[model samples]
Target: MAPNFSDLVEEARLSLQALVDYGDQLFNPTVRLGVTGLSRAGKTVFITALIHGLLRGGRFPVFEAFATGRIARARLAPQPDDAVPRFAYESHVRTLVEERQWPHSTVDISELRLVIDYQRPNGADRTLTLDIVDYPGEWLLDLPLLAKSYQEWSAESLKLSRQGPRLPLAAAWHAHLATLDPRGRADEQETLTAAGLFTDYLRACRDERFAMSLLPPGRFLMPGGLAGSPALTFAPLDVPADGSAPDGSLWAMMARRYEAYKDVVVRPFFRDHFARLDRQIVLVDALAAFNAGPEALHDLQAALAGILDCFRVGRRTFFASLLRPRIDRILFAATKADHLHHASHDRLEAILKRMVDRAVTQAAFAGAEVDVVALAAVRATREVRMRRGHEQLPSIVGTPLAGEVANGEAFDGSTEVATFPGDLPTQPDGLFSVPADSGSFKGLSHFKGLSHGSADQADYRFLRFRPPQLDNDGGDTPYLPHIRLDRALQFLIGDRLT
Candidate 1:
């Protein structure tokens, strides 16, 4: 198909922006790093810990520029984008360090600028401006909608709503959907009711029990300011995938709003924020998916693929950078490594690696460097060996959040306990296989019980732990402990620092 006038205009704008960005980079080098993840995937914590580590000189043995005494200073600078909100670094640090609590998750897009003064390997001094863009992963999933028509999206969404765990959760929406007539005249109250039910269904699917990752129309889950607006008030109709909407029909109203959503929400994000990224880190809650079973895992896999497809990923040449910049490096880090014992950490990484294997291959083939790591940006637990029966089991010791229950005992938030976090499958392939009915609803239950050295355990239940108490002796800055965060940093912006 030939490009439309709008497409041409969009391309021109992108080129103009890229040209300006390229010109700026020639004098003052910058790396626009994007950090995002699904709801409760620890994006805020990751960014907070990353900035704190760099500024306060936290322990990072593998981050060569920081560890080798080459980095003279790293400090916050004014972000270039005046319209965007600054990331609340000071407030979040206070929450984590002083209050000993996790900060609120990223609700909308925010930017933070870090300027690093360092000595190059050749002993020359240089500065690098690092602009970190933080947004929701749900927004990333919506990018693919640009290529899809309302009919196609409706058909796909309806099909997905009828399958597996979603089938039960979507019952109310489907019930209302059955009564709607796409060919009839559009009814205001009916449309409103349908939209409400659909939004409720999306919210239900997002429940930690279901852990459904592929739910799009991303704003429904995190509408921000778009709530109750016509743009977010459209629900998928049971219409023919190849059919066009009749003028002034129910289908026409929905189709129009869908287009509006794309124009108003998704497009600006892609053009202004996503397209400008030089590197990105997508955090995943693979453990949540694992507890939810194979269906959730598969859903998460599909979601990851969709997220990667949105990136204009490839190596950037000088001329290419002038017209269109590409994200040359991508990192997919599985968050919440502190929830598991050290022995299962590699296994967790393996599961994530398997999930993104196909996406990684495609990104690499397109000249993007992609890597995966299991990381806890703010480590909340410590490892220990506990005696259970005649043998010792690898256990993680941490304070379970208030009301968190394990083996019929509910924690009171202050009491610390040692529990054996179950082992992951030795090979991640088994996890991708069709699961039997036994472990499918593991996430719905309170706890799966501590595994007594069961190699065959498929349901790995994890308790949410409170942030560890940071020890500040003699007024020294307390370090936020992490797992493999340095490895993640190495793959993302290591070459630029060098």
Candidate 2:
């Protein structure tokens, strides 16, 4: 068997891109670092904090290059690709540093370039360019489609929809699917209605209440202006387990559109941005999965496994680029450490490791240097000791997001409060799920009837806090506070700077 012409063209493009990258890096040491995570995983905040840390020389003790004073300076540079939107660093940082508020999450792909001047151990001065590509982790969830046919995807999706937590949310979509005849001719309005219902189902699954993580066809949730287009209008059709779609039929129409989605949306993303990475970091809101209970935790684990499978996991070397790009290092960072007390940070990391164990193992088996960290790009809360009847407890103090309730009291977004964000188990085994006897749906009983303050009562649940206030020091000396972002930096790009 031989690769078809289309496959040949794709390979040529990949090789050419790699060659261009290699040639460019010979003169300018550049690392294409990719940052992405599922929605609300803090991709935007992570990028903002990372750039602010580098440019402002933020206080990061663990990042070797910065800590050892080997780095002269880091400055923003024009990104190499003009076609891609520049990450709005200035605006986002302002809201975070000045206004003391979080910025909006990422909706599409954006890039930033930071040029760092450093002194090598031998005292020779060198410069390295870091190109950071930030995109929605939702899109990364679609990579599995690269190897799946529409039928396979449909079957998998339908089967998943019928599962414990998803079954209820997928009710309408399943009903709509049932009404449509796969063998009949495709109708425009009917197709639109089905797609709309399917997208709605995905939205429900991704709601903060649910915190589910495995929704695919990423564009369905955040269309990015692709709404109503044919490529985004297809829904999975009901089909027999082993049957082919007939030409000019409803199933065929959906099949064409599904393939079109892969060709038009998924393939180009991999070819243009994904495959070019030298290092990658996947930020995870592991606590959310914990709060969502066992079913969501297992779903997240499955999602992570699928997403990690798409990586060309291996060490990046000169030879790797000559053939194709390889991501040498991959870091899975559990974001939002500030929400909990420092005492449990390691436990959080351990719990996240268990959450992503299979994915990390797969990447490690391929010789990729994989690491995990509990990080907060911005530490929104300060730790304090609160006494409850003579017993001192470690707690975090910050201004909660407006309307955040505690003990039936609502925060005004300006009043500071100290609350004990509960702790994780020293052993990671008992964290993601409750006992089966407690309730059904894979231990969702752990979060039974959780809402507002009651939900926050869950040991793993944490409240959202506003960004911390910064001192009078202006832009030139911006030093944002963070938790272990330096360690993350040390793992991802410390060697490149050296």
For lDDT, the strongest prediction is 1
Q: Compose the digit string of candidate 2's lDDT tens values, residues 1-498.
A: 356688788888998999998999889889899999998999999999999888877888898989999999999997779889999999998899778888998999999999999999999999999999999998998988877788888888898888877889989988888889988987888889899999999999988767889999998888877778899998987787578988888888898999899898998999999989999999998778766666767777777787788899897778878888888899999999998889889988987888778788888998899999999999988998877666676778888899776566778999888777766667776645554223444322322221223333433346789988777575553578899999999999998876
- Highest TM-score model number: 1
Instruction: Kindly provide the TM-score of model 1 when superposed on the true structure, using C-alpha atoms.
Output: 0.95
TM-scores for the candidates: 0.95, 0.94
lDDT of 1 by residue, 131-220 (tens): 999999999999989888999999999999988888888899999999999989998899999999999999998898879898798899
- List lDDT for all candidates, in order: 0.87, 0.84
**Candidate 2 local lDDT, residue 367:** 82
Residue-pair clashes, model 2: 0
Reference-based lDDT, residue 444, model 1: 28
